[model samples]
Structures are given as C-alpha cells and as structure tokens.
Target: MSSPRPLNRRHFLRTTSAAAATGYFVGSSSLTRGQESPNERPVFATIGLRNQGWSITSKSTKFADFAAFADVDANVLGENLEKLEKQTGKKADGYSDYRKVLERDDIDAVMIATPDHWHTKISVEAMLAGKDVYCEKPLTLTIDEGKLIERVVKQTGRVFQVGTMQRTESDQRFLKAIALIRDGRIGEIVKVTCGINGATGSPVIPAIDVPEGLDWDKWLGPAAKVPYRALPQMREGYGGGVPLYTNCHYAWRNWYEYSGGQMNDWGAHHVDIATWALGASDSGPNKITPVSYSLPVEYENGYPTVDDQYNSPTKFEIHANMPGDIPLVITSEGDNGILFEGTKGRFFVNRGKLTGKPVEDLESNPLPEGAVEAVYGGPVSENHTANFVAAMASREQPISDVWSHNRMLEICHLANIAIRLGRELNWDPTKREIVGDEQANAFLSRECRKGYEIDM
Candidate 1:
C-alpha cells in the first residue's frame, strides 16, 4: 500500500493562495484541470441519505457527483435516489449497508449523517479505507469515541470535516457573538448560559411489522436489536403505522440509548460557541457539577409522551469550570439561547438574534488579526458546504475539523455523563480517561451488539 499523505499547513496555504490567484474555486466543476482529470468530478457517497443527507447532497452537487447512497431504511434510500437522479442527472447506486459503499474503489469521500450511535464507527472505518469524511456533529456519541476518532484522523492522514455549520455562517447570531467576544469588546468571559428546548418521550402507539423496503436488521446495526416500530413521529414523513410505543429515528435524541437528548443535541451548537470564544477548543472543563435538574411528567400537544423512557437529561443546570477564574453554567430553559457574561459587559445570542449590553462594543471591536483567521483560515465564507468543499480541494483543515470538533464533543458527552452519574467527576484530558472512578469510566464507551465492534 502507498504511504498516506500529510496535511501540512504551509502546503495548504500555498495551494489555496495559488488557487485563489488563478480564480479557480476549489471543488468547482470548472477546476477539473487543476488535479485528477478533466473528464472526472470527485465521486462521493453519502451514508444515511435521509433528512440531513439530502441537504448535503444538494450542497455537494455544486462541487462533486454523488457516486452512491446508503441507508438502512429502504424507503428513505429510494426516495433520495430518485431525488439525486433528478437533481444531478446521474444514476447513483444504492445500498442498505454503508460498509458496502466503503468497499468501493471509485468513491473519493463519504459524507456521514447517520444516527449518533453510528457516527464514530462508520467515520473511522471510512477514514481507514482512505476516504476523506464529512461527519455531522456532535462528532461522537461518547467521550472515548471522540478520542478514538481523533487518533484515527491522525493515523489515516485523510481530511476530516465535522459538520458544525455554525462556524462558517457569518450571519449566524452565535458565530457573530463569538467574534465579538474574541475581539475583547465583551472583555473576559466570566460566565456562560446555554439553553435547550426539551426532550423526546415514548410513543403512544404499539409496535408493528417492519416496513417493506427497510433493512430493519441493518438499521439496528451496532445498536441492540429491538422489535420494529413505526419511525418516530418527529421524523419527516413518519405516518400511518402502529408506532413502536418507543421514540426512534429523529426522536432518538431524547433517549440515552441512541443519543444525548437536548443536552447533546442543542448543547453541541451552543457549547461549541462557548468553547470557541474561551479559546478552550483543545481542552475541556476540569469539572462538571449539576446544580439542578427537572424532567417533564407529560408531553405537550403534538409532542411525544414524556417519561423516564428517555435517558437524556431534559432539564439541568451544569456548572463547568474552565481554565479561567469564573465558572460557566450551562442550563436548559424554556427559551433556547446562549448568554455570555464578561468583565466589561454581557452578550446574549440565539438562532434569531445577537444582543448585549453596551451594544457599541460589538460594532467597534473587530476579531483579533489571527484568531478568527486561525479558526476558519480566511475570510468567512457565506456557505458552510462550500467551505468543506474548498477545504477538501486545498487539503487544509475545515473550520470544524475533527480534532477541534471532538474537543467540543467531549464537553457535551462529559456533561451527559456527569448528569447521569448525578455527581461531580474529575477529568484528565492528557490521559483521555475518567480519573479515579471505575463506575464513571464505564460510561466512556459502550458495548456494540455481536459482530458490530468499532474496530478500535
């Protein structure tokens, strides 16, 4: 086998600059003469071609062709295939198993938007197979998985971009707020509050026969095999069936078995901003202590039922100690937003707006010369998908590369672990292990079903 390629920073800069000078947009069809061959576009396969996968395909088609698509749910896979054919005017092969997609030699990269439990496994395997990966966040379901992915990226030498799109959107309130904080207009960040809406609960319907096209067994890959149930109602197009009486699919976030509920779901986005502004993307909190927690006893109208059925923390006040003197408290509340308190003033940001005291601070302060550039490597691109394509072509790290993303993911996972354990736990980042507590350490990794190991 050939030796892997090194992703050197200087080399990336040089190539990017040269490409920019030549007016050749990275990954553009017009740039076919730059590398590979004029007749060929980089071929990519997408796993979990359901909800987010379709969006990724729409974005990627501007740069590359969809060579294949994979999803355990045949209904979703077939629907996406038709869409891809219509949009790209290319007939793409379909697969019920992602492993089969990875085995092909023609594919250059793989975009993974699978469930939380499957992210690390498929991403690591794809990287080991010499394909670059575009993986969704939170990058890993567990702390150990994050560490393992970080190691795999280093070992494989393949470019890996985490789908933290907020990092690329200049108009996003959260990203703009961080830029203001890093500019020192907000002063030293003393506190942070992050809120998530709610959690998913059990379904009311009973289990039913599996759908026709779906490979039910494959859908449960790695996850323990359970009886077939209608996909969760929250899932797009979920209708007409005896619901499994348990939340599944998109609602899986509410369950501990499949995801980390709102904590990991929305926390991944908000906490990422907190880490980015505090300049703690490489390390994590020293301690995570839950000050308060509340779970819903019933579901809202049109919302799924609420019960201990879901393992994720629905409501909690988690105080985390960062490197600074002040501690950051991440809380879940009715309103979803992120508030940052600093020495000079306070700033609050959410999906819709960014606001703070002494508003002029934001207008006057510009990001530090190298800080913003270091994170994104250049002027902010309007499009997140375009940024990933550019990074792939220039061989540079994307704004949300695997290493930085895994660090943020570690924070979310640790917060969940602490909440589940219902106690304070010490963390040792250097060792990548939970210090001194065997019981807590057990939560770091999960056992897969028979024949479904992560290939550690």
Candidate 2:
C-alpha cells in the first residue's frame, strides 16, 4: 500500500481557531484558500465502510477524493481500501479507530455512515474539527442527539447534508408532491400514511465468540453493550425465505441497543418527507399513540426483555396528531409508500413511482413552473451527493438541513416511545417534550458509555 503523505496534526491544531472561523457558514473551501487553488477539490474520509456507507462513499468519489478511511471492522476496512484505491487511483490511510481520521489535516470533510448511535458524536466532532460532513439519515439515535447535532452545525458553520436523497433524485415526484400539497392542490392534507414495512424479526440469536478483524466493543460505541449475537443473514430481509446463517454488524438494526428498528431506518425517510410537506419540519407532533403494536419480545420502559431477539416492533401503526391536529399514520400495512389524503386530492409516492389523481392531472391543473426547483431551494441537483458538493461551494444549506431532519426524527423517536409504553402521550411542539410522562421523556436520550458520551 502506498503511504499517505504526511499529515501534521500539530500544524493543523495551531491554525484551528482561524480555520474554523473561515468562510461565513460556507464550505471547506475557505480552509484551503491559501494552501491550494480555489478550483481544488476537497479531500474526504469515510468513517464507516459497510453497506450504506460504502454506497454513499462510492458515489461521493465523483465529487471528492478519498484521502482516508476508518472502520472498526478490519475486514470491511481492508476490502474498502483495496476497492477505493483501485477506483480512485489514490492510496488512502486506513485506521481501525475513527478518531485518527478526524485528526488528519488533509481531509476537509467526512461522510459518516456509522450506526445510528454513532452519528451524532462523529458528525459533531467532525464539524468541530473544521471539516464538512455528509451524515447518513436517521441523523440521531434520539431527539436529544438531534438537538446536539443542530447546535454543532450552527456553531461550526460546516456544510452539512443528511442522506435523505429523495429530496433531490425523486425525479421531481417528491418535490412535485410537496408542491401540490403546499399549493393547495391537495386541499390541506388531513391525513397521511407512511408504510415503512415492519421491523426484522427472528428467534433469539445465540451469542458467540468475537470474530476476527472485528472490534465489537467499538462497534457498540455510545450504546449499551451486550453479548455478541449472531443474526440470521438471508439474501434479503423478511419476506425472502432464508437459509439461516449468522452475521453481526448488518443485524445491528434489529436490536434497540444500536438502532430504533424500522422506526429510524425507513421511518427516517418517509417521516422526513411527511413532516416536510406539513411545513412542520421545525416542529413536531402534538400527540402520539400506538394504535396497535406487535413485538418480537416483551418491552419494559421501551426496551426489549430478551437478551438476543430482534426487538423493534414487528407490526405496528403509530398515530400522530401533528401540529395542526392533522392525523398521521405510520404503519407497515398497505403499499410500501407514502399516501397523502387531502380534502381536494390524494396521491402516493415511493422510490419506485409517484402516482395519484393529482399527479395524473398535473398536465391540466399544474403547479407553477419552478415549483419543484423552489422546494429544492434552487435548480435540481444531479444527485444527493452532488447537492452536498455544490452547497460546499455555494455556502448554502443543502436540501436536507440538520435542524429540519431533527424535527422529523423527533416524531419517529416519540412514536417508538409511545409504542413501547403502549399508551397515548401529549406533546408540546414548542417545548419539544412530553407533557406529563417522565418515563417517556427519559427515552428522549440514552445514557452513553462514559468514554463515548459527548458534552451536551
């Protein structure tokens, strides 16, 4: 492997103050002004090199070079290193510990694809280190982490983008849908349904020895640690009859120890759009109730009882009374898409297609020319990563800002809390809290491992 050019951490630290203050809420270009040409491309590091992180980093290579790579799993890191070096024609420094990547002076930004538990810590630290960031969605594991990220963004003024790529690459359908709703084409949407599918379920996975090239401890950063459990890794998720085999990392989502099941997984996407359309992106639901829920294991105080079974709700419909008292249903039933029911019209959309009478009649009773573009805040971007790179140059907020995402994520987190408690809870959108339930409020944040905890 070709060695990376020298990165002087001391040199970087000396200029940290001035560098962080460069560019008035602009991109990392400000940091490279005197050292490199304005036309120079920014250097980046990918912190998690697994499934989603690899996909995002692979595409992001179109906009920036991979100067460094970090992952707790040595196997994934080594494989990504070979592939990235071959594809980019540039050797990158690989580190088992992510903190080393953050210390490098050459990397101007980082694409964080770590677990939901690690998102807030890494993103916040990356921004504070004078690096821009592209964080995967379900931006935080909790509502409190969401607020933490928002504060860091404003303080660091780093170019930030969440992985809600639908905003840019929905072929104008999502934007069109939002425009139609906002334009009153959908006559004040009274109800919305988000079908995200249920959480993955399985019998208790047996704990086993730690595998080679994997650091299970670091993988559980900020999350409560548990015995290593092997999850059934089928060709695909539920619905495909699986030959049972065992894996760990990919199965992290099935456990509440690392993620909030589908609530934060697909919920991150649909909930983001659903709330954005309501113009409640900065606020949250006024009330939340678990209409009905089925789980793989019993829960107490919003946590699973069993040690090794998948814990996310299997089949559940969470009812949310949004800011305007509009009823929002998040469930696994029906088509795997978002449905907007309004007084005047109705429509549905997902990664596959966007359709409904409103979309069909757009040719006749159409929105204004720039409706979709306006939702994007400008012209349509090439893709989500392209938007991140563009915003870095233009010093503008990318399509999915951190604050807006947190508002949406807050609802999903609350949904899980209400479901786990099996009760209705009152929420104050303005205060951003549960009205009278202390138990539910506690789930807003998790107690992080001492070393992994961040100052809030």
Provide the TM-score for each candidate, comma-separated: 0.86, 0.90
Local lDDT at 354 for model 1? 77
Query: In candidate 1, which residue pairs get closer than 3 Å at backbone N, Cα or C atoms, i.e. clash?
Result: none
TM-score computed on alpha carbons, candidate 1: 0.86
Model 1 per-residue lDDT at 395: 58
Stretches of model 2 off by over 4 angstroms after superposition: 1-36, 231-247
Residue 187's lDDT within candidate 1 is 79
| Candidate 2 lDDT over residue span 315-412, tens digit each | 99999998778998999888887999999989999988888888888888878987776665556767787777766654445677787888898888
**In model 1, which regions exceed 4 Å deviation?**
1-35, 38-40, 170-172, 203-205, 230-245, 295-308, 358-375
Superpose all Cα atoms of candidate 2 onto the true structure and report the RMSD in Å to 1 decimal: 7.4
Top lDDT prediction, candidate number: 2
Query: Candidate 2 — number of clashing residue pairs?
Result: 0
Judged by lDDT against the true structure, how good is candidate 1? 0.71
